[model samples]
Target: MKRIYTIALLLASLTRVVAQEAEQTVSSKINQVAVFLQGAQITRHASVPLKAGVSILTLTGIAPAVQQQSIQVDGPASVKILSVSFRINYMEEHKKPEKIKLLDAERKRLTTLITQEKSIQEVYLEEENILKTNKSIGGTEKGVEVAELKAAMDYFRQRLLDIKQQLMQSERTIRSYQEELAKVDAQLTELRAIKGQPSGEIVVKVSTKAATTAELDVNYLVNEARWFPSYDIRAKNVKAPVGITYKANVSQQSGEDWENVTLTISSANPSEQGVRPIIKPWIVGYNNALSRRTVSGSMMTVTAGNEVHGKVMDDEGQPIPGVNVVVKGTSVGTVTDVNGNYSVPLTSDAEAVVFSFIGYNAIEKRLDKGSEINVQLAPDVTALNEVVTVGYATSGDDDSDDKSRIYGSSAQKMKREITATEVIRQTNVEFKLDEPFSIKSDGAVRATDMVEYELPAIYEYYCVPKLEEDAFLTAKIMDWDQYNFLEGEASLFFEGKYIGKSILDTRNTADTLVVSLGRDSNVLVKREKKKEYSSRQFVGSNQKVALAYEISIRNKKGLPISIVVEDQIPISNDKEITVDKLEDSHGEYDHNTGTLTWKKEIASGKTELITLKYAVRYPKGNRMLLE
Candidate 1:
């Protein structure tokens, strides 16, 4: 009976102990609640609020042994048993450890190779220097034995070459090592990513510990959808100048949809005040994974003007296609057609049309009342002259020789004058020798050598004058036609000082002169063209007739002064033609009416007219007269 009582009491005690153990709750507190289920340590707010009844907690980077163990949570509620599970990132653990070891070994090997390569390169440089020093010493000392010195030089040279070769090999090895190291690093990074995190398993635990229970809810955060505006504007060649239409396209990635979005287009640089918007915003949505929207309006009128036509050509008289023709102040522009012709409307009152092409100087012309315009672009001779001529010539027999003479003389004179100015002028002239001139016995030349010469000369003239008082005038013959019509430039001087320069081109019937004057300069006297006689007219016996012409003068500065007029004509036949009505006053002549007149002092910027009239008759049978 004593043994039974003892056994019963022991059993009761053991049962009580077991019950107490069961009632005791185990709980844990994670400093960082959110942990990756793989190799990385992380902190994520619990999606579901932790409660006494049930909760899920995912843990990461936990030891494999600990992952399989049960986790208990003790809270201020009834004891509950929560199912638990384990997650192991086996691939991450296996790959990262192996890659780390390999990368460390490779890095060490590359470092050693680089260091050795540098040392070898230094050795080569030192050997080369030694060879150079030996050669220098051998050159300075004449008493040294030639053979010994030669042997020494040969030894050093060979040693230097060997060192260089070794250095090269070392450099190659180092480069190869570096490449291997890079590949190893990439492999290691990939391995680390693969071994990083396991995307499986969720753990839940419940404990009888004293912790408050709360209702749990889950929510997710995502990026919101928004609209971004973008546009591209361009203009085409048209008679009516059109303003740019700004178009906007919207794109979104997030699944949320947008509505009632307004887009506004405003010019950052408005040409005029109160310009209205052209593009209005429209609704758009994503289609087939692409978000886009296009908005267009009526053609905005930025500028409106009459249509004008023009031809573009280079200095060599060749038409240039695809030249850009732009209205100066606005974006309205067009390129020349295939025929080097462009027609564009004017954009602004102050704007000038500019014709620009590569390899040619740009030409700009201001819009006026005229509809027909011509633009001649100069060549960029400042860069290079592609064609040049060098030859000899004499005075004109039929004015054909005069062209070559002009080019040669101009080249020589330009070279001399270039010293006085900073400008360097280069002239390139080309003459085709398709027809050669010959001296015939009878002097009856073939076709009188009436050659048609097309002069395509390139002139690169730039000048930078030093003194403030010094000035220069240049007039280029922009156009020419007849052979007898002479076009030349001349500078007029007063009291050893240049006043102005004039470009004169005259036909037998009419004369046109354009004059440009320097500051504070005045023209007092008139210059005129000589009268031409009729080829069919017959002169009287011993007849000395003079035909006179007159020029009008203008002053642009101070009050004009009285100036004398002088005339001289180099007649082909001096005896047959004589001066009759020699005008001793200011110049005045009329080729059509055959009249001459004269006037007195001209005011500043005012014209003074002069004229002279004379009758001229050709001597009979004086057909061989030279002019």
Candidate 2:
């Protein structure tokens, strides 16, 4: 009985040892990354040397915020994946990135140097104190001569001066080190903010038929990574082709660095639910307090739209927190959250909502019922200088030929080599880069060039003198749908100079994609009121007001140009007020909006004058003002 009991204990101990050997931990490296609009898919590769039968493999170094449902593991045909799970390993610490390691070393060096300098300064201070304390030339019992006293005084003054100089020099050195340390600390704070709190581990249970080396491919979705599309539209002159450079700005804090990985920018938003929305019945009923539209009276119309909610992003597609979104001409307002998302109920008097953020240009978007208004605020150069954050870049770098510096350059003087293949998928498009790309775990954005297109476009100048005196050059591209452009912010350049920023709004249903290339100073426009036509006359109980304006355009661009001039006349909805067009207005009139458009081609050094005349007749007894 004793021998049998001992045998059972020995077998149990052997079983425990075997189980521990089968459970092994392996390190994986991220080899591929696909960044979407809202998230990213990370692919890692690991080599597992497995013995015959079942084995539990734990893959380390994954993003902490990975989506478990999206995790997938692929291995060699000989290895069968039975189960996979994820967990956080709080006890383990992943290796820091090379940049972070360097920063840590620098911090240590600076701190040591600062301590040494302070110690030297302390010694000097002590020496100075000793000299001041023992200032007498001789002891109290002994009386000194005048020559001896002069010599002692001279030595004391010179030594103290030397010590004071040494202290000042030491203080300066310490100050310099402190300043550098402050900068280093700031950088370290930013990096630590994006650093992973705990390491992530993926456990996989697999069965192997024979002893072999298996190559395991693991992929999962990470929520901390995203990318945004951007564009650069350039035109040499009115006659040149519109050069468009498509780019992707990618940012990631996924804990693991994507070093030398195959990068692909996808237009997919995996974070958004893929379910289709259901259409509800559009039932109109009597006005109630909860109704979106409510009429106060016949004269004073009160109409409201559905709640307006959308993101407010910058030109680089980064969300701007603390943005003020207020309905124009009203006190109703709301601020954007950290994600740059805001929702404000539209009031009856809401014509447009103004979005204002410091250091960015204010955007006023007209309200539309049940519409998402995603606005991209351009940086106000006058208020603040734009700062671009990247993984690494040297200040005052003289390497003009560096291809990496060419993307975000204000002028973009050099054309980068575009090496991305466009892949059209069923749901979205992708630009797969041919060369490997590396992005650190830090959240600094990296811009990659996708493709460059020199498309044929019609260039024309448009001016609305009453609203703006400058003429804006626009490029109209037909069949723009073939290019598969996502809505994004575009930087405009003309005549080899950067003009301003504009949005490539792809939501318009118009067949022609019109891109405004900023205002042109070469085309001068002016709108002046005509004195003779601006008169008031009394006819019986009614009064007639004649309003006229002259819009003039001069082509001082040294070349003949085609331009469109626009002016407007007020339209009254009341029956008592009557409006009539005077003779020879000579413009295409839109009766619904009271808008008049005139198209013309003016020669160089020539001026074209367009006259608009309109008359309004209203009852004199009922006071009305018309100008």
Q: Judging by lDDT against the true structure, name the best candidate.
A: 2
Q: Estimate, for each residue in 1-627, the C-alpha lDDT of model 2 and write its tens digit.
A: 999999999999889658745779898888989997657889999988888777899988776667777789998888999999988777665666667778989999999999999988888889888998987668889999999998998999899989988988888999999889866765564466344356788999998778999999999887666666668899887666778998887777667779999999988777565556698656666774444665544333334323578998778786665566766654345556656788865555556888865345789987653457899998656511112221211111122343331222343223343878889887788899999999887666678888988776666788988878999888776567788787665778988999876666665436777788888888999989899878889999899989888888999988778787888887998998999989435788999998888878889999998988889999887776565
Q: List TM-scores for all candidates, in order.
A: 0.22, 0.70
Candidate 2 positional error at 449, Å: 0.8
Candidate 2 residue pairs in clash (backbone atoms < 3 Å)? none
Deviating ranges (above 4 Å) for candidate 2: 1-21, 96-186, 282-417, 621-627
Cα lDDT of candidate 1 equals: 0.38
- Model 2 compared with the native: what TM-score? 0.70
Instruction: For each candidate in the order shown, give its overall lDDT on alpha carbons.
Output: 0.38, 0.75
| Tens digit per residue, CA lDDT, model 1, 276-352 | 34876555575632346354353233323244678886676655555656556443445555456777644324246
Backbone clash total, candidate 1: 24
